[model samples]
Target: MANSSTNSTPGSSAREDAIRFYQIAAQRQPTPAETAAYKFIDPLAGFANCELKIFEKNSDLGGTWFENRYPGCACDIPIHNYQFTWAPYPHFPSFYTGAQDIYKYLKEVAEQHNLRKYIRLSHKIIGAKWIEERQKWQVQIVQTDGRELVVSDGETKDGEQGEPFIEECDIFINSSGAYNNWRWPTIPNREAYRGNMMHSASWPDVDYVTGRTVTLIGNGSSGIQILPAILDQADKIYVMLRSKTWVTPALANRFAGENGANKIYTDDEKENWSKDPEGYYAYRKEIENELNARFRLYLKDSQAQQMGKEATKKQMTARLSAKPELVNDLIPDFPVGCRRPTPGSGFLEALCSPKVEIIWGEIDTFNETGLKTASGKQVDSDTIICATGFNMGFVPRFSIVGLNGCDLREVWTQELPTAYLSVTVDKMPNYFVMMGPQSPLGHGSITGSIEMLTKYIRKLVSKLQTEAYASLVPREAATKAWLAHALKWMEKTVWVENCASSFKNGSSGRTVVSLHPGSRLHFFDLLEQPRYEDYEWTSLSSDPLSMFAWLADGFTAAESSAAADLSYYLVDAPHLKQRSRCAEEPTRATATGN
Candidate 1:
């Protein structure tokens, strides 16, 4: 592994710094024996293949791990089941692992596969443009110190010098996980509150909840986790529910101890769970089968038949009413599974605490000290945490300028962002998005989805080298046809028609980022093999001039100059500066300016 002490050269462009980082990461010189392990496929028959570049936004990683540092913030997926089959966890433990364990497992994977050398930490992709002439992508990246660099030719460039620092790659992988970008609610008095307020993604480092009256906004997974922890510290804790949340009692949440629930199979339990082959193989197959079965049921909406579709709310209320007052505030008005169902932990125990309270009314506005609910009730609190999740409707912050200089966000403004199986885009060539639109798995482990996408990209890279193809993109017709099928499948699933989920059309007025309503197995089958016919392949030799034309036509010198001019005007304008600050900072006022 390369040493982490290397910093970007002073006065280097953001692109230059990116190139430096990429080079350092790409420095894993493969041995001849290792090179022989790669399978040469049809398209990439004779081309030289060496490295793979995965451009991930470090900010998203921070939000995923950093913001969600709640006490019980562990993964719901079983540890053994949450890993890639090819790269299984060596010390796979029983039961679902906590957040720290998941982070450790991810770090171990990066280290084990020598993936650490391929990651450019603290670097954010600012812009990516397709270079038609070179049949490559010109990716713009920003370093932590605010330097702008362009990476291509596998080298980094300092923007100030206007020299080529890095050569762009044959393929790009985006592994930005879901929920990195926050989606705040648009309720009354969202910004006017004077108390300390924070989003689940922006939880503070201090123990401010101790001896204080705390109000937690949102009742999602994070909300459920926080309720129990804060109840121990806060003098009075009120869990505010904007909409109803689905609840399922998982063994991990129900049983608490060093042993917890036995997710790992014992010799005796394994025999019973499988009743097939003896020993470890039986255990593995049993667990995988059980998870797959649940995934199938989730796709089929079996829960609706067992408990009734609308009956989820009433059933949940009754379940919690066994403890009284807890059900009054915890029960949501919306249908269950309208939002994702979180495993109900010691939230019932916390509500039973005399110091805790549940407020069901909507917020009217924020006063000088506390929140004023629409029911004319005043709830006083010192610290307020907004568990309000991310803005799912928004596309990633990365700027993607595609055909005719079209922006990706603009194209996906109204509809939920659609991609060819949540991987390729129509206008974007040689660019692959990891965990993109409609790729999230409602059941089963997300690591499975990540592994599938990574494998597909690996295969595509091999194809590019074999065919000696310069670039490959999904054909427009194929993209549309696939989306039609995906939508049709989604219509049958519960999230599409029954749920009032943020994953649906609740916040953005459109559902832009959710998977097809189907079993994870079905999704896995779709991505198990590469469908080459679904894409359009362009060779650098046959369309050499066209590649150059695309590059030349992308951003002209005049356009670059215009962008710079606009940047100057926007930066210097005093009024715009104030507006920018307000836009960037989350306010404690009402949702709307009522």
Candidate 2:
């Protein structure tokens, strides 16, 4: 639980309006015990007791806090709504916290839950392989200090150089997040440019705009935030748009009310919000309804029958005409949602600056001094920033060989990545993906999704330990059926039809990463518990103690000719290998490199 001061009012000199907006939006009060029954489940308590490990590549927690460190990087979701219901933070200040606050909150959560001990900071996971003999996963991780950490050891530390390492675990969880792995377009001579260049994910620490000509590529969220700030420092700022971006106006607020609504809420206001059951409920429902209604209107009016491309064009034209010179280049040919909508506080105003220029053209190539456009025009610049997003479509960059040498990535490559309830993989046993493909909640805060997933994972681990199960893997048929339903559900949603956003497929031209059309509550309810029927459990009961001992010792009936001839042994065999000595010999041969 968070401290009481978080809900208190701000000081007089502070911004009261922003603080109040966040308070209403966050719905910071706790739910009734009945509503939060799952939080008290002993399964999570037990799971938390066990040693956990998280593999992270960077210093920051997620993409939101990692890449977009621009001057005005702030969350759009109200601060209260963004928090995890189970682990509430009473100290959180506003509804829409800036990047620094978000980072602080993540650190605070880690501290509160004692999760820092579990995280393997600056370690990159290269590969994971399932050892059928041990019925455990061998995770291969490379640390920043160039040391390999294997799970077999209770703790990972600096070991002798060139020594092999592996970590053995009953389960695996991937929370690599959506962005931070930068992806640059395949433009000719893009690397040959003799100018300062940086990706939005890896922003340079030094001053980038000291009254020099600057070119910013890509008009996504980061671009919107950067353009306005850079205009104040740069002599000439050129915003290069490879594709049209949807610009949505953002609502900015300031504090003007009495009381320190600007500094922090008073003790009374905090208590009122937390303890008043009816008032909290009403306020929460109101915010949820408002957000839902806005989403509905956006989706409804986006249809061809309502406001088609012509209407979008007209709206964009009017917006661009505010700065006539930008009209020729800033307007896009695609639909508004075809890409991610960029919300801006001063994007339109920034473009109206005489020093700013918008270039709407394709880059032919980058020469030593400047970029050459498709129209044979050359734009000179002293510095170039590649704001083009990440490679989300290509996930699990490492190969995962599960039971029977089945490659998990290979299976997903043949079809869109799908899972049983978006957590368990079909052939991959005991492997849990935190936010797998098509499971991202684009309309809500990802922190909410993470909390929900943590609950689900806790339950799964409990089932495994309680059942004395050797391994648990998703039933192939169940996963196939679930994926079919998921694809069908996505077809009815706006993400598939609206935009050419990276959340969808770039090659096949389909939306496969984000969630299907549904409310956040709907997805939350579905993921609340694990559907047991969708999985196949393998246990010790399947084989007696003596038989299990023999299996554990790497012995098979084929090794003993007398036992091999017994039909009773073959009857209990899990696979066909017991009947064929020659077929089984190859497994041993491959294991020993014979």
Candidate 3:
């Protein structure tokens, strides 16, 4: 019942601001005379309604948490830190809850908020093109029952019957996350394997992995967690590693169990959290402060980072003592935070088991039964489980064509996929993104920051809705300046160290492409207000004088409203304005999502 308040500073709450301007478009159309009245100004005059649509590829919600059901699939970030800042849940069973639990929690959220009405599950956006004449995006989408998609201008890649239909929108928001589309390892004769093969993302039942000899690839986040999870069940496991990586405890490990493993909550603890709002808020703030402060660990050669590395090494070395040689093969030479850190609970212990074997070097080829190593060593297994991760090279699952026939995919492919504040591109007008390249996800919690970014997006959309503006896109010079500044700041961080990372082009590249250079709080501050000066816009009215079209009538709708408070600005007002609620019908929308 508690934990509803967010942004309890001096003035209005961020949550209240978000609720007030929730996706509404201009209500009134201003006449030519009103628009041309340049001297007259109005902050809010013609603002009304807007429609929001969500296209989900899967049958259910929960993007990664629903898809990745691997043996030890759980959030590396604790549940408290991962939850929405505005809508914190009092009852999370564990600090690192499983995928199922996470999915169920999301499902409950959708139902409670009536979000499914705006969402079209089993729907996927195939392509998007900016129509200059209309100042809108013509988007193509299709309903799929989880079939293979082939988006093309001519024909389907498989010649399937699923033809995409088109829908036009004033704005297009892409939430197609980096890890949505997966790719197999580029091992020669990968398809020739007759043995059972499965990806960590597209995992089947745990029964399928039981009693089978498994050959695992990639020791990243997924690989790290899967080892100990299936160690006791599988007959034998051969972990294939291309390079070494550090396995460190999770952020805010003091709030978690030993070595930052999952900490289960007791019934009494849940009851206390549900009742004591201040106590729960204090606890949550303490955890978040720790999470934000740990950004210092990424500062190259800093005292905090050095101490962190040594502490992590001590923990990892002790755990790998049973097989001391793993210290050389498993630990990385580069500093911590070079690669994404995950607390691989019992992973080092699993390596000590006789049934588990660690193989060095990449898979040169895959045989009919298993893998053929670069040294011509034949590694046999009953099943090959490739945890070799997603195609996170910034390639889109669907095509996106921006202004002047500029293909966004080509731009990203040819040059670095940069953005304006990691939100929108140069030519992609009327476009916004949730989690894009160089986002605040490095030191920040992924899902938690998404909520913040959505508020920023909401603020931008409100301008287009209330103000009589056709569209606005980031300026080319502004984007370039932002990118250059980001790159410069990144050099001071540990991410620039020589390490094999998905963030870079490959093992040797020093450029960090995936994370924001600044801290989470810095990103939040940067996005607290929209910078309209750095953008190029076209007014809704094409007339040259219509540039001031937002000043129509020099009046605000609030002045006419019966429930509005005229003296709202006065400090310590005796009474606050109270507005009547909408009827049940319009308050709850059941329109079919396009």
Candidate 4:
């Protein structure tokens, strides 16, 4: 049962990873339990395989990076860690890069992988239902030119939207990330303001901010970044914050700029990385290691947490010394990492500027001209920007009906979002999710986890394709066990503290839903291989022998072809010599955090 695929390179790309996983799997035999299940041997027939397709609501791909085009809309994560390992771009403009720069890089990766042709742009998934008879998903799609806007009032207008259509697939993967569903502020009478009002998610042109008095609300990640980006363009600005948040310093490497300073790497420095590949790898790993060691700061009342809080306060106070009143007004008493802190490079400097006005209070109401505060003060402005973020719950905005017509939106939203390892649903067969509930994407560099999860998903799909499985679904008991483990582990993390973070369910939610309750590396370890025993499966074939269908005709597709690498295993025979398991994956020492 050797794999027909000749792809030997692992961790290079998704397709290659799948091939490697299957190749490794082919050399092994099934466990005793996998061979003993009764319902698994029940009467079932074969299923059909369909062609692959991808759809994007936008005219282009880039998902959130394309959607959030606001001023100062740059990623807080360092550019080194922000990019994919498979597709490396040596020439990064700055440490904290802009959104468009990322968008372009992502597009380049897509085109390099020749994925653009498979993706159907300007098309969105509005509804999905499980068709049991067909053993597939019937997905409803809406094709658009990508100009429609869902305003604050939850209405779509002033843009063209095409009629709905249907498409079927053997498996469905939801790639719509957590932050894509941007929401407006829930303040009463939000529609009263007739000025150039915009949400941070739906940013207009920079020209819209020029020569105007701008007011920014909600000092989240976007708010902190937008203040500095608009300071030069706007004549004056008034910022309002409903609660306090911590702003972190830079991930200062030796070859970089000051904290909050976006360092544009010199051409010479960028070229040197290209020439010295090892040096660049070390540099990237250094930053990753530094971040990796910082997990101890999240522990409640730990020495690192205490020290980090004091250090962050000192940095913020010193930076905002020009306007000392802000120190007491903005600094939160909660733990430093209670919410995910952004690397707010220019935020403190912008607030210290004379042209800016900081107001810490709830918005009473919005007038035709400007906004009014609950403190009996009025701030008149030409433009009002609601840097209000999105609902971070992993629930889909569209309709999704699973087995027994179980509604995904209702199950996730009405109750709690219960996902098996944040990849598959409890009852939804053949459906997979990326960046779903209990995901570990909140830590360190997301690209690393993304790559690991890519391999994870691809491996599962490979099993389904090669094995005789019609559908796979997580058992409800397994989901409960996973969720219980998550909650118990989360008790010691900073994310469960009192804070109004997007990580939680809502303003009053204490349960952290946005991320996994473990170190980023630990999460990667869990997803290293798919756990077949954790899920329930229905084979597409009736005969028990069909499970070994991969043993097709006593010969592989590779053996039939000329110019095949028959001696490939022996070609790397020297490297294939025996190695200890501990040598392959070393055990962690319980000595220190750093």
Q: Report every candidate's CA lDDT.
A: 0.56, 0.58, 0.71, 0.71
lDDT of 3 at 249: 77
**Candidate 2 error regions (>4 Å):** 1-49, 59-68, 87-95, 146-164, 249-286, 292-321, 324-336, 505-508, 511-513, 544-594
TM-score of each: 0.72, 0.72, 0.86, 0.85
Please tell me which model should have the higher lDDT, number 1 or number 2.
2
- Expressed as tens digits, the lDDT of each residue in 1-594 for candidate 4 is 233222222222212111212111000001111111111121131112324466666667676677788888987877887776655677888888899888888777666756555567666667888888777888887666665332211134223376888887777777666666677787777788888899899987557688888999888889988999889999999988778889876754343476556789899989999999888989888878887877778889889899889988988898888989888988998898888777787898899999988887888889888888899788888888988888777777677899999989888878778688888898788887766788875676666776566567656766666554677898889999999888888889788888988778446467876678788888889998788899898776555645544443445546655988776666454545444544675456623433
- Rank candidates by TM-score, best first: 3, 4, 2, 1
Instruction: State which candidate has the highest TM-score.
Output: 3
Off by over 4 Å in 1: 1-48, 55-63, 90-94, 145-167, 187-192, 251-284, 299-304, 307-322, 325-336, 505-513, 543-594
Q: Candidate 2 on 35-106: residue-level lDDT in tens?
A: 112332224443422445555544434435644576656666555556655555544454445677766766
Each prediction's total of clashing residue pairs, residues at least 3 apart in sequence or on different chains, is 59, 29, 5, 2
lDDT value, candidate 1, whole model? 0.56
State the weakest 10-residue window (summed lDDT) of model 1.
24-33
Which portions of model 4 miss their true places by more than 4 Å? Answer: 2-50, 146-160, 252-256, 543-594
lDDT of 3: 0.71
Please, what are the lDDT tens digits per residue for candidate 3 over residues 325-358? 8888888889998887787777888989999988
